[model samples]
Target: MRIAVPLPGTMWAFDVISIIQIFDDDSVMYGSSDRPVIDFIANASSKALDHGMSIATTALRDYHEKPDLIIIPGFANPHEIATDRRTRDAKARLFTADPADALAIRDWLVASHREGVEIAAMCTGMFALAWTGLLDGVECTTHLPFLDDLAAQFPKALVQKDRLLTHNAKQRIWTSAGGSICLDLCIALLAEHAGQSLATAEANMLMMHYPRSVATRRSDGAPSVLPRPSRQSDEIIALTRRVREHLSYDWTLTTLAQTSHSSTRSFQRRFSEVMGVPPSTWLLTERLNAAKELLELTDLPMQQIALRTGLRNADSLRKHFSAAFGVSPSRYRQDFLRTELRPTENV
Candidate 1:
């Protein structure tokens, strides 16, 4: 595969260089001759980019016929970086990028996309992609801060805030929540070209887990408390999946124990040994975690949340939620939760 990166005048330097390095380093780790070739292209060679630097690029001479994939890199946020006026001398041009440059990039991207070049965009780089009208009716994501803007700017495009990456093979477009997560997009592209094992090995070499496979509407991606086993106990794993799938089930200690093929007393003892907490404690924690997730990701009424979490009612959930989080559900959602388009008011 030949991937072309269009270095527009407003493109972020880090987004360009880091994505290049990720592919290069992982290709080395992949240790294969059939690796994808990445090309850095420019609208014109030896031009200054708006993010305080200049670059020279040439590989894709004619946008309509050259590359298999095209990457649009995110640039510095003109509004945010301009706050410290005295120190941001190099990036001042970002505040007033030429209208012609913007329109030219959009037109070229639209043409290239029409010619069957798969496109990947990072963060605000999506604006150029969206401007071509190709993102209409397509699901996409960008930086969390730009989620609202992307939605507002392109009303026909679906904006997903919680998702780290989105790919629509039909449109040949891929968008990602930007920043370092751009590398996650790189790894995913690597996995697509190579295989999951190469992706897994590349991720392990980077000392990071593969970001996500199928994304849920979640913002809670905290690190695992337990070290991941290379091979998990199938019984425990399947049991855990079942419990989560039906968290509202009225689970008695005896019923859960029987699922593990042990007496209640023996199960409790082994469960405590394995999880470092009593089984009862684990149940409560899981229920509360479910409740908290509902609070963050949805505006579901309190009684509905309680039912899904197995707390059975608003009264039961409030009692446990207050003790564990030290705040009301409304307040927690207000403080931490951001919806795909807007934050929820008290529900």
Candidate 2:
């Protein structure tokens, strides 16, 4: 059977690939293995992990054939987690590397799933799969630290917050929680094709338990390793979430501080601590991001797009978009349109 793995934001992606490779060889599985064929895919530009490693990846759009299974690995967002452990916005962070790139990957995943490919996500990679709408009304789980955020962001998903691993048998989707438990997910997937005995033996040889053990949850339902954020930090996170959801609102530092129930000074200090950006700067960045998505996905006029993103006018949108992307809005949209019309056309 053929398997596809998308090169994700985390170095754990490599770990997942390594496990698959170990089971892929003839010596290991011999007569019992499915003899899996693996492919590493990414968007046009290869993704660089936060840990300073990069891999050569086949562009998913250029890969014509669908594999029997697709595995999405956890995304690395250590900085965000470190700042506010309890409020790690999984969906927002999914767009951190590049919104267009993330959307392309999500679109490909949606199309591939519709074609009958079994999809699995390791740890917080469930955020990527959730963005594809495959997890709606289906049982799923992610890294414990991200459980609350994942549920808040994707409410339709039946998120088993305490489950180390869970599967939707009908849809052929699987999810495993954080840490080395992702290794267990790979073995579980193997059992679907290979016999249980072979899978059990492989787990034994690897010194991992065959079946998932009950994951202990704290009384407060928080990940023990990630201490809850301070009340001030939670307030700031809530304010930021509101800002993201309502980009069309006219937001100012004073108004933002009011929303979070803090003074201007305290609000600025805490917001910077949690988000690593001053309120105004973060607002501009988010507004421009909304504008970028609008440019790519809609046929609205520049003025309308600017208004929708709270940029006031086309000229303002052009200035900020050109400054940020090194191209005017129209040019960027033109390039996107051409790419859409000729998907296989290489840049």
RMSD of 2: 20.8
- Candidate 1 stretches with Cα past 4 Å from truth are 26-31, 47-54, 59-65, 78-101, 214-216, 220-347
Model 1: residue 200 alpha-carbon error in angstroms: 2.3
Best by TM-score: 1
**Whole-structure CA lDDT of model 2:** 0.69
**Candidate 2 lDDT score at position 113:** 88
TM-score of decoy 1: 0.56
lDDT of 1 at 148: 78
**Per-residue lDDT over 1-347 for candidate 1, one digit per residue giving the tens place of the 0 to 100 score:** 56778765556777877666666675465545435566666556554555578777662345444566788888666244323233223332332355455456566778888988889888777765776788999999887777877787678999887777888867888888777768778776665444344555566677553244223233432222543553323455566668867999987789889888989988776554444445566677668767766775678999999999899899999898877545677776665433223432221
Q: What count of clashes does model 1 give?
A: 0
In model 2, how many backbone clashes occur?
A: 0
- Give per-residue CA lDDT, model 2, range 1-347, as digits (tens): 67888864554645555456545745566753245667778764566654577666687668776787898877776334323423223443444455566667777888888899989888767777887889999988888778887787778999986577776657888888877667767777765544333555666677552234222222222233533589876777677777877888888999898888779988877776655446676788668756866776689999998988889889999998887555799987886566446423121
Among these predictions, the greatest lDDT belongs to 2
Off by over 4 Å in 2: 8-14, 25-27, 30-33, 78-96, 213-347
TM-score for every candidate vs. truth?
0.56, 0.55
